[model samples]
Structures are given as C-alpha cells and as structure tokens.
Target: MAPSYLSIALIVLGEAFASQLPLFETSSLSQTHLTAKELISSKSLQDRIHVDNLLERANTLYSIAQLGEDEYNHPTRVIGSKGHLGTIDYIYSTIAQLGDYYTLSNQSFPAVVGNVFESRLVLGSEVPQSAIAMSLTPPTKKKQPVFGPLALVSNFGCDASDYLDLTSKIALISRGDCPFGTKSSLAGRAGAIAAVIYNNEKGALGGTLGTPSPDHIATFSISDSDAALYIKKLKDGEEVQASAYIDAIVESIETTNIIAQTKEGDPENCVMLGGHSDSVTEGPGINDDGSGSLTLLEVATQLVNYRVNNCVRFAWWAGEEEGLLGSDYYVSVLSPEENLKIRLFMDYDMLASPNFAYQVYNATNSLNPVGSEELRDLYTEFYTSKGLNFTYIPFDGRSDYDAFIKHGIPGGGIATGAEGVKTEKERQVFGGVAGDWYDPCYHQLCDDVGNVNLTAWELNTKLVAHSVATYARSFDGYPKRTGIEATAVLDVPLSKYHGPKLQV
Candidate 1:
C-alpha cells in the first residue's frame, strides 16, 4: 500500500532535517542574536523595513562593483567577475551574522560565463559610436582589432545567399528576421571577419548570442541610427571601411548560489523566495537586480526576529543574466519527493525600474500549478489594501521562476519592468514616461545606484515582507500539495517561456 499523508510528512521532515548542514559561520552569532519567538505578521516585518537600509545596501553593492572596474573598465557584477564574487561573499557574510537562526549553504556549480573587455565600432575613422559586445563572442586573437570593408548583407543575414564574396570583410546586418546567433553564424560562414547587428528600434543595444559557437565571430550590437548612416553610405557607393574591436572571452567557471532557511520552521513545507545576485556585463546592476536581491537580504535579515511555522528559504541565485543558470541547475537536481516539499516558489527581480509600474505576475497560464493563481491573489490583495494600482504581467518566465514552474511548482513574483516600453495606459496608471523604457538603463552602463527609484523599491520591499511573513507563519489558506508524481505536473511547455534571454 502507498504511504499515508502522515508517513510521507514524517519522511520528508526526517530527510530535510538530516540533510540540512549546520550554519558554517559561528563567530558573530552573539552580535546579531535572535530572541523573539512571536509569530511573523505583515505589520511586524514591514515595520522593520526602512528605505535608508535599502539605500545603504545598494551603495555597498555599487562600491563592490567599483572594486572590479580595473579589469572590465566598468563597474559590473557579472558572474565569474570580481564584482560578482565579491557580491557572493557579501551575501554570505550578511546572513552568517544570524548564525543560530538559519542554516546556510553555498551551492557551487560549473557555468560557462562570457566577458567582453572592449566593443568598438568606428566608421571611416570617425569617433566610435556607442556599442556593446554581445555576450559569448570569441575574443579577437592577441587583442588585435579586425579591420575590413563594410558589406551590407541582403535581407537580414538569416541565409547564406544574402552575403556577397565577403572574405575578410565585415557584414553589416539588420536585426529583425532572426536571433542574433543566427546572423552571427551566417556572417562568419560567409567568410566575414566580424559582424554588426543594428537594433530595429530605438536606444543602445545590449545583447547576447544565446550560446557560444565556433561560427560566431566578434559580433557587436549598435543602434538603428548608426546602422542607417552606414547603410546610407553603402547605398551611395561609398566605401565604408569599418574597424571592429571586440575583446571577449567565454570560459568555464564555478559560481555559487547562497541558500539560507529559517531553522525553527516545519521542514516538510517551505515557502521559497529568490532573486538573482549577478548582473549583466554592462553596469553595477543596482536597479536591474541589486534592488531585488537587496530586498530579499533586508527581509531575511529582519525575519530572524520572528518565528515561522513553515520553512522559509531565501535564495540568492547566481548567473541569472546568463539565462537563469543557477536556478535551472537547482531544480534539475531535486527528486520528485524533494520537489513536493517546496510548497511554493516566489521570484523577485527588478523591483525598482526608474519609471516603474506595480506589476503582479498573473499566473493565468493553464500550465501553472493549482495554487499559482492563489499566489497571484496574495500579491494583488496587498497592493489593493494599500490603495495602489497594479498591472498584471503574464507568466512569461523571464526570471528565476522559470525553473520552478517547469516542475509544476506553484510560483508567482513581481517585476517593475525591463527592456519593455511603458504603455500610455501604464503611464496613466503609474505616472511615468510612456514612450521610454521602464528601465532605460537596463543591461547598459547607466544601471547604477542612481537608476534605482527609492520610492518604488521601498514599497515593493514591504510587499515582499508581507508575502514572506504570511506564508512563513502558516500555509493555512494556501493550497496544500497533493502527493502526486512530479512528472505529472511537468506538462508545461518549456519553449513557451523565455528566461532572461532576449530572442532578438
């Protein structure tokens, strides 16, 4: 006969407690000791949050990013970089202060990370236009720049026939027909030494090649106006000689994900909240994710003062900008039984876009688990209670929640915005510039501490505290997971949602 609910609960509890490693850092437990045993509530936790604390933390992250500026020539917390490693240390040390209240462990995994030292595009010896190196592009040999005559590819460089006899020439391609990876591959195959992909829309382009390929040459993304100038020159039979310098390298490195859980809660049922700790290659990422990660950190810090009947796992994921590498690796390792113990998962990413909108993930996707809608309702109710207007964003799987949702784990989260433009309707509701991107500095050099909107970030942080405290105290109203096989819930289409990676 199959095991009863009590037996399964007992088994999960025993295994969870047995497998949990002890808190590794023991030095400063006396300094930030936990004493309160009162039940966690929205008021109790939200009252502890302060905007000053968030600002101080964001400033600290900026300083850490600045420490690695000598290597990248920019302050960035990209994975495998000095800034990101420093960030990992910061999170670990911060959580370690509450040594007796939580069990902390670092999950180390091998990841292929890309680094771009320089991305330069100069037309006819004029000043270099603003350009960013596409991630995963192979570095030029011995730091040598590739100089060649610019040749425009017919169509969007999606096919081989679109190229002319381009041996030792650079291919100038438009960005509409296909993925950046396809264009780069075709350009290299056509004997082009380098390639430039211009955006189809406004603003500077910051992109990735999805994955590294031997056929991908030194590819860079430029704005549409720059592409237009070159196209006009080429159309007039002008010899637009181009010089491309892309210093980039892809290498395998070990990255760490910091996992911390309350030691006093029931281990069988857990409420997991996560945010990516690494940033893109362009900037300090203070707003893009520093806001979200620091929010979780701040909440976790304050949470130690209260008691929880259900487990609360706070995760600082690594390699998120590289397509949710850390979270994906995490879920892939969980056994079916282990997957069920995680009652629900909530992801927080980019909570403070400069021109922000209160977005709640509408878990209306048919593939989302039974309790996903309930999770959405929880966030909506919080916003409603505060008389705040919020818009519903689809469960597009753009962040760390993609991995959890794939395994039928009930999930939902909040995002201020990313590269998407703010609609006029959104402006009327949230009152920001409609024509501009929600976060113009997203994935660019301008995404530093100044990019964060303190007002929006603080509000969202309170919501995070509210949701975490609610679930931590009890999953009473939340749907209980039936002891169904994990495979049964794995029917969600993985291809439907794009995690962090932009197809363009």
Candidate 2:
C-alpha cells in the first residue's frame, strides 16, 4: 500500500519538528507593527541602514580569523579553509536566529581549491625573480630545480609547429592570442622539460590554465623586462640557462552556500542578491569581498525587522575565487520553475577597493538579458539622485552574476574597482591617484580589514540596501520573468573583465 500525502506530510513535519528547524508561520507578523507595506514606504528601511552596522559586521568577519592558530597564519576566508568555514557558520547562525521570519538553507557543493606553495624562476644564476605558478600546473616530479636551455617560441606557442626541435629546453613564450594553458601544453608536447611565459605588455603576469591538464608541465610567468632581457641575451648568441620550480596543491573540497529568503513575501516573485563568501588564499579578503558579503549580511539582518511584497533571497556563495563555482552550481541545479521565480539577480563584489570608483554593471549592452537595462537604470538613478558620478563596466560574466545572467535572469551590480589602474580622467572625476591600482592589495596578503576605503564601502553598502528595499517593495517596473534557456551572447573572455593581470 502506498503512503497517503497527508501521512507523508506528517512524517516530514515530525522530522522537522524533531530537528527543531524553524518553519515559517504568518501568525508571527501580528507581534510587530512593521508590516510589508509599512516597511517599504518613504524609504524608511533605507534610512534605518547604517554604515556603522556594515563595518561592525565586517570587523566580525575579520575576527573569525583570530579564533584559532590554524586561521591566524592563513587569516583567509577561502572556501574549505577554517576561516571560510567559520564565516559560513557565522552567517548560518545569524540567519537561523531569524526563525520563522526567514527560511534559511545551506546549499552544499564540491569545489577544487588550488594553492601555490612555492614558485620560483632562476635565469642563468641571476637573482631569482618571483614568478607566480599558473593555476592547475602539475608539479614537476623530476627534480627540485629543472634545468634546461631556454628557447623562445614563436607566435604565442599556440601550435605544435611553433615548438619544434625544443627537446629538453625551457620554452619561453609571450602572453597573448591564446590561453596560458594552450601555450604550456604545446611546450610540454614539444619535449620541453619546463616552460616560462613572460608578459607581452608591462607589469607582472598572473593567469590560470583554465583547468587541470595532463599536458601541462610546470609553468610560470615573469615580467616583460625579464623576458626581454632573456630574448636579447639569446639573440646575442648567449645561452640562457633557466631553472624553474613550482609546488602546488589542488584538492577537491566540500563547501556550502548560505541562502536565506524572506518568509513573509510571495515566493513566486523573488529578488536575489549575493556576493562571494570566500577569499583568495593570500589574506582575509576583508575588502575584496568581505565588504560585499557583510553588506549583504547587514542588509539581510536589518530587513528582518520589516516585511516584503516579493521574496528577497540573500546568498553567501562559496568557491567564487575558484571561478564562480558556487554561484554557477546554484543556478545549474535550479529547476525550470525555480529559475522562472527569480525576477532579477544582483551581484555585489569588491565594493571597497582602497582606490575606488563607483562602477555599475553595463546592462545597456546588447549582450544583457531582456530586463537588465531597467535594472541598470534603477542603480544609475539611485546614484544620480545622490549627486554621484558612476561609470558602466562591461558585463563580462566574471563575477557571481555570470551564472544568473546565463540562466536568462536579469543581473546588475556595483563595484568600487579591483586591480585595474585608475586613469587620470577617472582621477579628475573620482579624486584618486591616476596611476594607482583600484585596489593595490587585491588578492594579496595585505587585503585585510584595513585595506578598505570606508567612504566607498559605506556608500556601496547603502546602495545595496536601497536596491534591496526598492525591489522588495515592488517589481512593477521590472519585466515579467522569462523561462527561456540562456546562452552567453556576449561571452567575452574573463581576462577582459578585470584590470591588469595580477596573481592568480
């Protein structure tokens, strides 16, 4: 005999009750005068949001690293790390305290996190220059320092023919035209013992192989000056002997995305906003994303004091540094009906670059979804009303919103800036050093709580709160949700989305 629906429901309810999971109950609203309609009126909720609250939360996130010795050395909230897991616990517990007002779930997913233990490049016994190991490059099993005669490859080394007769030599390639992975694979196939790729333009080279490849030998990148000197030495009939070493670990780890949605609103129409929860292995990443994550958390926490018309979902995504894995996984697993319920998606990332610019995602482009333009306009209007000048950055699917956009969901967000150098024109408009990077400590050990620009951080957080409040009040100006299968029409390479190439 099959079980009845009522009996199944009773069993599920019993399990939930036994587990002490808080379930949504509309009766709870009677205890407070802050009803959904009242909460949205006259920008009341926005006024309640304070920058102090956001900073306090950010400090709390930073303190998570101070809890124990393991995190003290790393001091990073990278996914699967102790600091990151601690961050997850904080968010989960914080949201769980809201009880019936919000429904919270931890979405689990698997991700492979890579960390470069040691990377070095020794050219002809000169002072060894620092070189970043390309992500996913296999460790050399032969010896600690693989020695070889340096040979230059032609045309970016994308083809096998470009690496002919390179047996037992270190193939030196330039950055351009193809991925670092392609060049590395071609070097390995041509019987080269190791590979060194230098930057074509100015500055240090930092990139990834996109994925792990067996054909990828140990590869590293140096500066353009270093490569130029080596090429010139080789052309002058000087043998350039190079030694390269890289030790790295790539491990599959399990992580969770903390998701919370308002229980008081219409679930059929939902507004989603999120930022990456994890940081790079270098530091605590307080500004890289701690600014954005805590902004969402602060906004979500304050929103619990009120109500909403349409559901607002807040997510703290993991594995974002590993190429948007968490957000991508979240969207990939959603059913068609679930996808359609999402009216719009907003991403908040890197909102506190030390040298900042108020940048909104460029949704006016042809590559955006049907309703993205309106979303962009809403942000523009919000900034304009405040007498702020903002610029439109390309929506190149680099951040967490990439997945949402690929699912046909209209997506937009704001960024202060990252490693991109601030130009003189931007300096005239935003009042910052012209040649300085937006965030000098991006993905570095210095990206701690002190790396934030409080002015930008506070302003960006308020903008987040405003957006949330506006959309939660009503989706009247936004287009109806479309269930059409999404394709990345503007699929620009990830390299184009960020500033200059920095460390991986």
Error of 1 at 48 (Å): 1.9
Q: Model 1 over residues 231-333: C-alpha lDDT tens digits?
A: 8999899999888887777888878899999877889999999999999877999997999999999999999878788889999999999878999999999
- For model 2, how many clashes? 0
TM-score against truth, every candidate: 0.82, 0.87
The deviation in Å at residue 81 for candidate 1 is: 2.8
- lDDT against the true structure, per candidate, is 0.81, 0.77
Q: Please, what's the RMSD in Å of model 2? A: 7.1
Q: By TM-score, how accurate is candidate 2?
A: 0.87
Model 2 regions lying over 4 Å from their true place: 1-37, 67-72, 127-130, 165-167, 232-238, 491-504
How well does candidate 2 score on lDDT at residue 142? 52
Worst 10 residues of 2 by lDDT: 1-10
Which candidate should be chosen as best, given lDDT against the real structure?
1
Model 2 lDDT per residue over 1-504, tens place? 112212322232223221322343444545354463356532676677677777777777776644322634667777767677667767666666555667778788878777777777788887436467876677765537688899988877878878878887888898887778788888888888788888888877777665566788888887898778788988888998888887777677778888999877789999899988888887888987899888888788778777788899999998888778889899999999999999889999999898899998887536767788888898899889999999988777678888887788888899988888999999998988899999999988788778898898878877888888888889886788766468446446645432222222
